[model samples]
Target: MPAVGFSPYTLYSREEWARLREDTPLTLTEADIENLSGVTERVSTDEVVDVYLPLSRLLNLYVEASQGLHGITEEFLRKGNGKIPFVIGLAGSVAAGKSTSARVLQALLARWPSHPNVALVPTDGFLFPNAVLEDRGLMTRKGFPESYDLPTLLNFLGDVKSGKARVEAPVYSHVVYDVLQGQTLAVEHPDIVIVEGLNVLQPAILPKDGETIPFVSDFFDFSIYIDAAEALVERWYVERFLRLRQTAFRDPAAYFHRYASLSEVEAREVALSLWRTINLINLHENILPTRQRADLILRKGAGHAVESVALRKL
Candidate 1:
């Protein structure tokens, strides 16, 4: 561990954190990792062993504790074992590799015998449809908090935490860049639910009537924020954009199909412009502000490799 500091987090080097994975069995193969990783994001089995195995163990400890606490509280209230899902929130910038983290964690946590049923929910599904955003004139601010249907998202999560069964959420399509009409994702009873988004940790907005509304983070049993330098994130975003141009953007059905025909220089210029005008603004104004609210922070270095870990002090 690094020397104790004045910060509320205890920092550990990658070497020190990897040791915490002692005796934790590795079940994922290279193919599994490749399938789970996002475009332009590199995640090796070695990275999983060093970074995520310890994270899984830590999450298991928290889940067990939360289950026990829920039992005691329910007994005190004269209720039955309703089995509420343990919720985890993951927040990060656009190219900070949060999707890969959520998928990897879902895969690893499901392998634990104690919690075989895990569900992953990307909050993109909660975003308002493009049509709705256009009506509100928020198309340019798509990833901002205002673009989401906060009431519906809050209700869905509240239902999950209340042990409600068969709760459904709208499904968003990246291919078309809109919420799918008449399509929904059912989140049945599960041992754990991982909610990943850029604004998962954002603070709640006060309504005009001054009635207090619950923030999404209020339901989280644990939260994680993936961090990297802004310059590195910008570079990653540009690289990912270039990769998608040759792959997904080549599909006529893709929302960004127009980018497929651009030359490499033109593609890079477009990506940089988008980063400067939209993504960077969102990162600075919303995402990075909530970093301290996370229970754990994974600091990434070049090549998307996690260089250090900071676990919040109890």
Candidate 2:
């Protein structure tokens, strides 16, 4: 790794990132990037635009590089060999805005000249369905590492890496808070595939005596973690919940319809209570600890703008 003084790695303020964006000649703009990045506040923070643009550019470069490696491998193996998809993993806390980052990076990176057919697969699909968790008496431990289908998730990554044709993964619905029954997503041959979730970078949870299986993070060609202070994330969680209550929950068909009729004070209190009881506990217990393992970390300030980017020395 390059010494800190000379390293290409940067951790810059939102204003500084914005300045960099303005100075750059190769600026690529996304449609409604603000909304796409979940920047609800009315401020010109460059967390998504500045730091993320460069990061997306970097990932695009990696995709192209992987293609070159694939070509070399294909030539070595002769006619029968097929190339596996390049996989990138993204990790972050509940309201750190990594979901928006995943969406932005998916669209932006796909639009890049290097790799046009990038795929974005979220780990939510790999979560045990709410009913399944309830059946197993683990509903309360939902976001903990144990709640995932670890072997299945590992196998999915393995299959993707094995160059399988037309691999399909299950679909999960946030509105229903369950895995959609019988709904699967087909991931065809793509130059790049990004996997995003809270615990993608987490190490394996296995018995000491068992045969060691590669954790999901083992397949990551590149990884990113979106980060913020716990208090900040808590605030965002509450705010997002409030917004959802007024909007999505208002629909009679919505799964959280019970929250829709709540008054502002009641809704706010419930949102805070939920965060304190569930999400915050999960963050402290499972999520925050993985921040150090990320290849890249996008650190945000109090206003939800990414204040700096930290790249682990590879």
Which structure among the candidates has the greatest TM-score? Answer: 1
Compared with the true structure, model 1 gives a TM-score of 0.96
lDDT of 1 by residue, 96-139 (tens): 99999999999999998878889999999999999899999999
Candidate 2 residue-wise lDDT at 65: 85
At residue 298, candidate 2 shows an lDDT of 84
TM-score of each: 0.96, 0.88
Residue 140 shift from truth in candidate 2, angstroms: 1.9
Candidates in order have lDDT scores of 0.94, 0.78
In candidate 2, how many clashes are counted?
A: 0
Per-candidate RMSD, Å:
2.8, 3.8
- Candidate 2 lDDT at 90 equals 91
- lDDT, candidate 2, residue 290? 82
- 10 residues in a row with least lDDT, candidate 1: 1-10
